[model samples]
Target: MRFKIIFPTGYQVADILNDNIDINVVLENGDVFFGTLFTISNLDYLLAISQEPFFYASDLLIVKDLSKKNIRAAIESLVSGSIELAFTKIRSTWSNESGSDSFDTIIDMC
Candidate 1:
């Protein structure tokens, strides 16, 4: 089974599994960086979006909403400058690990 996952903006990251998905990140500083992804929960992700040396869940511009609790925890972890904690909180809620993972991948190859 294949389905489309689209962000609020037109930007889309295809094949978001552990497989490196090609996506462009526009940082808060207006600098655009291009790369394939690891786990989006990785610290590299926080670094990509944040202009600050210390990163947070609030630092994330794109969010994967699972539950209100998950979103709140993600922000709180960032507010505390714990990117790993933020990752842990958000990682649990990522849809890929849930029902989505059971399906065959669907993606646009950039």
Candidate 2:
């Protein structure tokens, strides 16, 4: 099933999923950490971390929602700072069948 993501800017998309997803946290020094998704409540997701909190997915950009098939691919692209590529890959794997076709076509063609 597909989930909707409501961004603070009022942007909404139906491609977001509630299951395992990937996110990148970019810090002040430009360092990035890849986290496995845990849950998305309201506008935040609880990510799986190895440190004290044991997990964290706060202050996320909700960048991209991925499916099992493309999660790894998306994370790899995100780590390299390839936002476009990551989203592109994710849209291809997570797009809803009853939703808009624009995204579907783009993913298909890509």
Candidate 3:
């Protein structure tokens, strides 16, 4: 799945671009997507009436809703910058181990 969020102002866009902030997408399901994906300047000029900067996360895993605790854990792991570690733990239990091997795989997925 591909998800995108628009920054209403230039300040927000500049901060995201300059700081190279990692985007963490916690779906309603347990699956989490984390990546640095905001370099394009004119990705959606026509779609955005204001032409604000848009961040798009692609190739995310699709799953059902997760428990509240699991959602919190996913958020914590992504924010802590231990995505690989988190995925390593999750992959052991996750049926689709093929998708959650390394950070490079995560990047490629995103």
- Candidate 3: list runs displaced more than 4 Å: 1-19, 40-110
Deviation in angstroms for 26 in model 3?
A: 0.3
**C-alpha lDDT score of every prediction, in listed order:** 0.34, 0.35, 0.34
Best by TM-score: 2
How does residue 11 of candidate 2 score in lDDT? 23
lDDT of 2 at 55: 48
Q: Ranking by lDDT, best first?
A: 2, 1, 3
| C-alpha RMSD values across all candidates | 15.0, 13.6, 13.7
Please give the lDDT score for candidate 3: 0.34
In candidate 2, what are the lDDT values of residues 1-110, reduced to their tens digit? 11222122222334445444444333222233434443254233333333355443443333345443344444445545744432322223332336533322222210
Worst 10 residues of 1 by lDDT: 85-94
What range of 10 consecutive residues in model 3 has the weakest lDDT sum? 2-11
Question: Between the candidate structures 1 and 2, which one is better when assessed by TM-score?
Answer: 2
Candidate 3, residues 1-110, lDDT tens digits: the string is 22221111212334322232234443323445444333233334323655556544442221122323333443454545645543222212211247553333332212
Query: On residues 1-110, what C-alpha lDDT tens digit does candidate 1 reach at each position?
Result: 11123222343334332222333322222222233223455456557678888754332333343233433343444434633332222222223324543223323222
The C-alpha stretches of model 1 lying farther than 4 A from their native spots are 1-18, 39-110
